[model samples]
Target: MKKIWQLGFLLTMAFVLLVGCNQSETQKLSTGKSEKTTQTTDKTATYPMTVKDALGNEVEFKEEPKKIVSLIPSNTEILFALGLDDKIVGVSDNDDYPKAATKKEKVGDMEFNVEKVLSLKPDVVFAHESSAKMVESGLQQLKDAGITVFVVKNAASFEETYDTIKQLGQITNQPQKADQIVAGMKVKVKEVQDKVANVKQRTAFVETSGEPEIYTAGKGTFMQEIFDLANIKNVVDDQSGWFKIDPEQIVKRNPDTIIVMEDEKYFPNIVEKVKQRQGFDSITAVKNNAVVKVDQNLTARTGPRLAEGLEEVAKAVYPEAFK
Candidate 1:
């Protein structure tokens, strides 16, 4: 009787042990599955990037930055457009975009006070390659102390401007958004071109940077790109992009129209002033009263509003045809 009872107890204990073991195995399988899912998610989060600048500098961008500092006025505008204004830690004194940029703490004047920039402790600093010699060394010193400084090429033409915006969008992890903005601009520019496609082309001169001898806007400039779409001949050889031309050069080219880079403060009454210049009556632009005024800001800068700038140029060049 005693042996039978002992055997029965042993059997009951064996059953309990088996039940616990099964529960433990089930939990182990569930935990393993959770780990596998986590690893798969992490594996696909690849975001290393590379880019090139106008100065032929190959830039390798590897991480998403939380804090950025811009050293140029144009860069400030671009940064805000890329949805980085909130992350921007510092800006140049002249940054006036999004209106909020005006209130941010300024590191320093565009090319002044390197120490102020270092004090901001920016994760990344954006500068112009053209001014690299003036500021790149200071930036490198900050880089050596574990900072990242990036230089963007200054774009002189419309295509380069588009490329710069596209590249910046990638850096900010907003490539799709950047392309959308650029695509809209291309559409607007094309509309103007298609309108003037059949218009009678005209010869012209575009003066840039007010001067004693007119320094005209020519090829490789935003003004020239607009002029091309307007189907106007830039009388001064666009060979050197821009050069000084006297009244004789103007009459010799015999441009049908002349457009001055106007400053409201300086050339308030351009029509009367242009009429009084010596030997000006012989020129077609002066004779037909085809002289027009254009804002210096719209004609020069590369910004989101450039499409509107192109519109102003196209209309000024061929008012009747565009209408």
Candidate 2:
């Protein structure tokens, strides 16, 4: 009787051990499945993001874009700044900065070649407001081909410029970087502002184009905003937007400083040209030899480098501040 009782006890103990081992294996498999689920959730993007571009059109992206094409130089600069260079498959002919852009496949300027853009298989294409207008039909066709096209409006103010940068960052999953860029720009602009705080605001003229017809920046233009930030009053602030100013009108304004956009091919020796303008000799800028030549791209392109233009203008307008 004692031997039979011991055998029963040993068998019961073996059964309990076997059950515990099976449960352990099942728990290990469950844990592995849970970890794999979490990883998959992390990799998937929350999609179907909808945004209204500068043209007031609602644009939607089904998923995060992996390939892109920039139709304007400003957009290209913004993309490059956001560290999306590898994603940019094509750029406009005018995209010369960041040097790397020049080597990308060129989709025709102004009027984009839909065929070339399609051949690159870009998930999204950025177009300027003017360029979109120029190729509305082509854009519609691209949209019909299931391609997403976003038209960036011309940013006339610093706030608008920041909005564009942030919007692009959101589209590309780099909003943090976008914010950093804008913050850096703000800091630089504030530094310039601080340097010119007590300085008296002077009247200045921005010569956009010269010769038979003189194009100047007026109110609601980036140049005017830069002028305002630099503690200078735009001599043509009375007019609205970009307009041609008669030589006689410029002479009448008689600005204290003249900033000419340098385009050697079109307006070489622009400073000398301004000095020789019939009746411009009496102007304060010419008399003081304050005809400063600035890079056209820096002043004109509404991208990450705008603050640099602002700083250049401040230094040009007030040399004593730096001294």
Cα-based lDDT for every prediction: 0.63, 0.75
The C-alpha stretches of model 2 lying farther than 4 A from their native spots are: 1-45
Question: Across residues 203-280, which tens digit of lDDT does each residue of candidate 1 receive?
Answer: 878765344646664454445656776687887544544555676777678778888765545556765677677778
Residue pairs clashing, model 1: none
lDDT of 2 by residue, 1-323 (tens): 32232222222322322222111000001121232211111212245556566577867776778999998888999999999989999998768989899999999866778899999999999987644666799999899999999887666567767777877777777878888898999999999999999998888888766777677777666666788888999989887666668998988999988988747666788889899989989999999999998876786677999899899888878888977
Model 2 scores worst on lDDT over the 10 consecutive residues at 21-30
Q: Which ten residues in a row have the lowest lDDT in candidate 1?
A: 21-30
- Judge candidate 2 against the unseen true structure and give its global Cα lDDT, from 0 to 1: 0.75
Judged by whole-model lDDT over C-alpha atoms, candidate 1 comes out at 0.63
List TM-scores for all candidates, in order: 0.74, 0.83
lDDT of 2 at 313: 87
Report the error of model 1 at residue 207, Å.
1.4
